[model samples]
Target: MLAYRHLFHAGNFADVFKHALLTRLLIALGKKDKPFFYLDTHAGIGRYDLNHEWAQKLAEHRDGIARLWERTDIPGPLEPYMACVRAENAGGRLRWYPGSPRIARAFLRPGDRAELTELNRDDANALGKLFDGDRQVHVHLMDGYQALKAFLPPKERRGLVLIDSSFDRAREFARLTDALATAHRRWASGVYALWYPLMDGTAMHAFERGVVATGIRRILKLELSVLPEGWNESLRGCGLLLVNPPYGLEDEARKMLPWLWRTLSEERTGGTEVRWVVPE
Candidate 1:
């Protein structure tokens, strides 16, 4: 599990989908006057240099952020996400990409807070250094699941939690389902976002069933696939399960994901879906 470095896939299609949606979540929180906390489990190095050897090896950004870097027709909701990327790479060249922590930090207001947890030593240390002088942010070098238990029901009592785990370990789907259900029980009001890669049909079905059985309502499921289900490529697509999602998130995603699929999909064989797994 430690072998999986997000730097290798920093600006890949999946990151585009996840980060775009993340921006919306934070924006929604800001709509309310009350302060909110943002938690990033599996927080990678706060930022990524796409020119780095690992990132350049695959040049995933060429298929991800590079597609949107200079686009003038970006949908309204995606403007914020692209702005974050542009901010990272000044001088009109795509050289850097912001991870979840960095994107969340951009939207943090005077009273807003953020917590980032990463089990990987190097990534944790980098994240620590990235937010060293910031008082509104805290970085924890610990297991994301453990951090969930320790930080739930945040004193603010309102915020978003993103569980963007690296699914390098076996049975990660089941583990995520259990953790989500437990977290919902502890803080039903908190917004929870869980990211997972699209994989085997049987496993995905079981994972869906587990979430349904949790008795948690208002769950929204959003997926974007850049390749056919039969494609044997590394990652055909990915999805995010949002528990207690904001009111306008589905509308925003509907407008945003299709454009992403069109821009990032190679063969145009993939698609997007935004629906409620459990309605309010």
Candidate 2:
């Protein structure tokens, strides 16, 4: 059934990797002023209060973002990522944590439009209010995976789509892998970012193979493991699979991964890799 609350782990390691990519993507889409569109599938509760009982219970952020909070001059490639976190965590301490939807909304401007979809009714309603007064952003209470099929090649014809889900339900992968084939077919030039876990690196390979089989021509995969290769013998790592990723992002990941691995290493074999099956 795949039912999990993001509040428990808002700014954990996953957010670090996912948002790092998203920050770079928004920067790319922001390069031009053609009114690019931003779409977020699987939007969670726009804002998160780490102090909340749910969030405080785990306090994973203490180890994740907190570990990298200070330390200025972060890496060249990681600057944007750090910038976004700092912007979100402004106001002295980390009181509120913005999820994908909230972070996407921050980039929206007068002409820019943001479309967010959340399958969970409670989350959808909350997501809507997150941007209630903002006419530039629209929130839909529906399945993000389904939205992939409905909203593509947005009106502007130039934009970024973020597919970020907890994958609480394994079916999400099935739907996401299929939707990529369909969405890319409709808007092959559109930029799409797919966030995934690395518990089982092998399974992720299969998913990427399926995506490559679609022959999208341009796809990049970035994987990061908190534990070393032999650290957790029974556990798998985590990674993000990107479609139509911006130019030079793979190299960016290449540098940022090592820094992250060093800071969050749980095993001796833990490391990072940035590679693409298609030409950039």
Off by over 4 Å in 2: 229-236, 267-269
134-233 in candidate 2: lDDT tens per residue? Answer: 8888999878877877888788998998888777765666777888888888888888888876655566667777777777877777877776554445
List of clashing residue pairs for candidate 2: 2-168, 198-237, 198-238, 228-267, 228-269, 228-270, 229-269, 229-270
Each model's C-alpha lDDT? Answer: 0.92, 0.78
Give lDDT tens digits, candidate 1, residues 207-277: 89999999999999999999898777679999999999998999999999999999999889879999899
TM-score of 1: 0.98
Cand. 1 Cα-lDDT:
0.92
The alpha-carbon deviation from the true structure for residue 187 of candidate 1, after best TM-score superposition, in angstroms, is 0.3
lDDT computed for candidate 2: 0.78
Task: List the candidates' TM-scores in order.
Answer: 0.98, 0.91
Top candidate when judged by lDDT against the true structure:
1
